[model samples]
Target: MSTARFLQIHTLHTYTAALLNRDDTGLAKRLTYGATSRIRISSQCLKRHWRKAEDPHALSTLAGYVDAYRSRELVTEKVIEPLRGRHPDDVVNALEPEFQKLVYGDKADKGKKSRQTLLLGESELTWLAAEADRLAAEAPDAKAAAKAAAQWVKGKNVSVLAQNTALPAGVTGALFGRMVTSDPGANIEAPVHVAHAFTVHAEEAEGDYFTAVDDLKKDEDDSGADTIQETELTCGLFYGYVVIDLPGLIKNCGGDADLAGRIVHHLLYLIAEVSPGAKRGSTAPYGRADLLLVEAGARQPRSLAGAFRRACRPDVEEALRVLDGHLAHLDATYETGEARRYLSLAQTPLSSPEGSGLERLSLKALAEWAAAQVGTGADA
Candidate 1:
């Protein structure tokens, strides 16, 4: 068992004129809450940005981390392609269908079409390639090879095979989880619960009209813009919430408490520093959280989104005050005495209720404190 059952994290980040996330029709995403419209960023978008971040705090940079591929072409690209020239064409061709069926079940296409994208770790893919090669070499013809592979699949246990891999679903899958409906055993329950971030107040957005000029055109030429378009841009203070299930995370990392601790540490940085945006070059959307509050406790986690239920002012200090007030209300009603630590960049710090020992620390110290709560001091 871990020291803490859950680590609840709440953050307030402000962005300038940038389209952080967009709808299908190319407009800034919005959600109506408390009977008011607010700019929204999906949890999926946040997870993707954090998973693929290239910064020093990126999960991919962790030691012993394996890459995972989520795609429809996983069998072809990772399993079959590597074995194509190395083995006979007939043998290689025969293994594709059987592997596809093994992975995607009865609905799998014979010509390498998957019912859905499969998320597989590098070790699992490597194992499949080796298994295909062995089955192919033992068979007399393509027909025999296919039969042998299919028979092998029936007799084997995929989940067991997956567990045997050095890293089952890789770092991202371990953190964000993966769903393989074909095989429930392959599904990993996500330990990190991310809420869709929304603006504290009403949406503040505008349509930005832009033109693309043809640099090669001379003054004598058409003297007109090559292309013109409009895009939606919004600026607001977003409230982001995330929950870490310590026991779940530790189990997913194969009982490595130290590794789990490091993961938590790096994840804190990713959440606060990584900015999810649409147009990077044009928007240059990047900002760190102005206020970060972390709570460690053994009880179920709750979000501070109620702080913005009535829509506070755009200022960070106002948001903080509202947040503190809401938290106090929850404490008074439920008496949930969760150990709390916070970091703030605002001129006015968080005002905790008297006798509620809420320690304020810097970002580095905050992350370190979270890692320690998970029972380790190792660098992320």
Candidate 2:
């Protein structure tokens, strides 16, 4: 077993004439660093793309993986809907309010049909459905069923009950985490941490005014285009960062170091290959990482975003050079004993300072090497 506690992955990817992420106003997201605006992509957006990608390396392909759902109607769809025809209508209907009150707050009113969305594991939903069925079968009436459910809510533990059905956390919950405001025991702390990606240089965008012409327009009709619109298109070289807590990942996987290792391997592939974008039909925004760097160490993870505080040139070589200098400075000051591997598409080889311990490797080798660092504990 390796003695590494943290695995950090960093990448530099460039996209052209694409709108990857947008705000409510239909513009590219931006972040101000060093008093200059930089195009940005949120961590949430990046994770969604990676998690939902239908590739060979997807997390859904892992053995013993349970699917997870996020929705405001978890109780309605999973519990109440399944029991509608199987049990008495009144008994099943009574569960909605009780379950809502349990999940939301005691004062959750019926007037608001849409509540805060929640992430629930498939096992947890199955358990809830089974409980509803049992209550419907045993209750003499809806009132008794409601009272019994309230009592169950007051006494029973959700995490314990869900564990019987299947893996309660699911793969996504085990990696990204789940939050239950009313039930603290159901909450899972995310072991994988993601940072928002931003361009290394100042923000650059263009206003694209476009129109679609109707194909069946009559002759001499002199009609205008069928539709007209304008959007913001941006070209940028973005720097992305992700960190995996080895011990926390193993704990989330029920102390299975092998499973944690497999997860890390698959996640590394997704990070390097997945493309996050909006307006896919029009923009066709897709790009692989220009540089992929993986680091393994026992120290707490730190982001290298500060290297771009002064905003490097848009060229990948220039950005990488700036990063190399910053890394040398950090190593000199902290003496962090981290093992590093990287793959670069640049023309020149990466220059690491003496004793920096940075090695060059292919993406496949880098991913495997990082996964091999997963162990049971810090002292493993």
Candidate 3:
């Protein structure tokens, strides 16, 4: 019987599952290690889990990999043993090949069964049984043991393990006691959440901005001279917040307030171009203003609600006109083929209670109405 060398490996499955179940704000808080900037999951997670399925082989392989590392004696003898007196870098480099072989072995022309059953029968069985035994041993009583043994193993703690990995400089800012970084250039922080995405869905039409503007102007005045004289502008308003990992920002910027401000501006500009709207205070109101933030909590509720209420002030008709003009300007400037194509697609008219109109909309009212529209559209 071949004796398997032990290794200690940590898995992030449980942490990821917890993150996935959490609300965006909660997730942002937990993941942002103290940076002012928000961190999001990399494209890697999206690709991996988007279509992943449970496979017995994969599960068994993971179990074996974990068992090999869980043994303190084996780990000491195999891994830490070699590093006792050696430099860390040299030790890591030397151990890499051996670790790889243990994790993933080459099996040329081997039968599936033989490859699947790499460890001896007794060893494999021991590996599988140890997980249950460990839980049982750790429990305070028999009842607790039984319950714990039945609970599925979700592997080691990830946040703790990730702490062992060092973050790059200028990537440690605090958001509610958690660390986050806003240094756009720093890439050490693991992307564990996605705050926003730029796809075909948020774009607008090429001529839609101009058309909307022209229509709004024409509606205001039927006089042909006034219509022709109105400035033909194109623009859109894209609103969203880039969660700055406050700690990370401080770390990168060395606590430079000016640099942090620049970073915020740059990120806002980037997100704005993706959506159809001129930035806030830059142009007239578009059809609707989207508030995009890494977490919903990032919004200053009183201030935001006040702004929306002010937009609707004077009268609903005036507000709509303002919104139209703003949206038109945004579309004209940032209307890429991607955004234009998305706008060209047919959309259902918003379904509302009979006689619902802008006149009835306060900031809070508008938000509620918009929420209903989204819910109905999604259901449809």
Whichever of 1 and 2 has more lDDT, that candidate is 1
Q: In candidate 3, what are the lDDT values of residues 162-247, reduced to their tens digit? A: 23222212121111122212112212342112232111111221221222234446464463433222222222221122233433
**Backbone clashes, candidate 1:** 0
Writing each residue's lDDT as its tens digit, candidate 2 over 60-118 gives: 99887788888777778888898888888988877678777666556554534546567
**Is candidate 1 or 3 superior in TM-score?**
1
Question: Which candidate number would show the highest lDDT if scored against the true structure?
Answer: 1
Q: Is candidate 2 or candidate 3 better by lDDT?
A: 2
- Residue 280 miss distance in model 3 (angstroms): 26
**Local distance difference test, per candidate?**
0.84, 0.83, 0.26
| lDDT, ranked from best to worst | 1, 2, 3
Per-prediction TM-score to the true structure, in the order listed: 0.94, 0.94, 0.21
Model 2 C-alpha lDDT versus the unseen true structure = 0.83
Off by over 4 Å in 2: 109-114, 157-167, 353-357, 376-380
Error of 3 at 225 (Å): 48
For model 3, the run of ten residues with the poorest summed lDDT:
7-16
